[model samples]
Target: MTCPLIQKDLANACALETVKKIVAEIGDGIFCVLVDESGDCSNKEHMVVVVRFIDGRGFVVERFIRIVHVPNISATGLKKALETLLSGLGLCISKIRGQGYDGASNMRGHLGCLKTLIKKREPQAYYVHCFAHQPLLALVSIARNHEDVDWFFCEINRLVTFIRSFNKRQDLLCKKQVSHFADLIENELMETGTWLNQELSIARANDTLWGSYFRILTRLVWLFTPIVELLEDLNSD
Candidate 1:
């Protein structure tokens, strides 16, 4: 009880005072809310809420108010928590002109999503998806719309996986890299034991991350010689 009171209670009290000051400065101003949920190494769910509003000088400012530990995340729980947080700071739900989510799969679902629930509580709070995902979505769209591009990615992804799974192939790849480096040194192209920043392993591409294809292509370019020799060695084995 002593430890929790000192660490948690005292800390929360200080945070509350700071929020009160910030809210007082934004009196009667319309603000937007940004919400993101994350989990730490202990698998504890945490919700972060930020408020973006125009200050007295007409400049926009964003301030992070609270990070609450939640055992689970649900539409109702999130909405209630958000309401309580704002009300604790003497803010009105109607002042929330917008709401934003990370556009993650869990939050994007049709049923009981955070953005949807938020709008239900405050109809004026418009939903805005994260802009960072636009490029990723474009890549996914291109892959889905084009058969050739899709097949190309699938084949490269499988090839990288297969190479990584085989110990002999990985050793052969390192050997080829060593041999190539030796030649470069012998030819005075680079210093002996020159370390190329690129590692020998083939890079794996994530299906959901944006620009992973570029990563695959870049790795292929750097390891072209060693990869070719490795393939030939595997064939002769």
Candidate 2:
């Protein structure tokens, strides 16, 4: 049961059955596609494909199609990969009424992009920049335009980098957290209960995704005193 090969086989079978059902559900219907590509932890580029359409019950449904490993992420290469995937699933490119992708040059470029290529093949396959990423992009733009906001984020990044730079510093942080929590419990400032006093680590803000700034700010507020003490201890040493 723990064999890697057997596990892979089982996963593949499950994916196949799931995709078959999705394709059946999308049968003879005009659908929209959403595509996104990113590098995995192993640094391999994989593109995710999802099909969205209204079902017989008149409810909109979105289904995962497959993840395709693409060695080349050029617009032409991605278009070919998408074409082959849809063909294998017996889905026609002409039936694609919409294309949703990020604003990456290779994806939404005016010329020689996945959007343009698809539009050329099927003129009705209109493209739209994905709505999910709009808030993050807007926030980043506003930060750049506002000097104070940008500076605050920069200082936060520097603080996280300095603390996470050395193993000894991290160890000191952990010790400070334990001591602080113990004091809180002793003073009845914090409750003593199961799962109440879990340890926390500082989170660094990520530029590409939403809520990352909020996470890092929340963590900083929670551990502000410990972080300041750690910095002072390092300065004295």
The model with the greatest TM-score is 2
Query: How many clashes in candidate 2?
Result: 0
Question: Could you tell me every candidate's TM-score relative to the true structure?
Answer: 0.58, 0.66
RMSD of each: 7.4, 6.0
The residue-by-residue lDDT of candidate 1 on 151-177, one tens digit each, is 887888888987889787788788888
Q: Which residues of candidate 2, in runs, are more than 4 Å off?
A: 151-207, 211-237
Worst 10 residues of 2 by lDDT: 202-211
Worst 10 residues of 1 by lDDT: 191-200
lDDT (C-alpha) at residue 77 in model 1:
72
Error of 2 at 2 (Å): 3.9
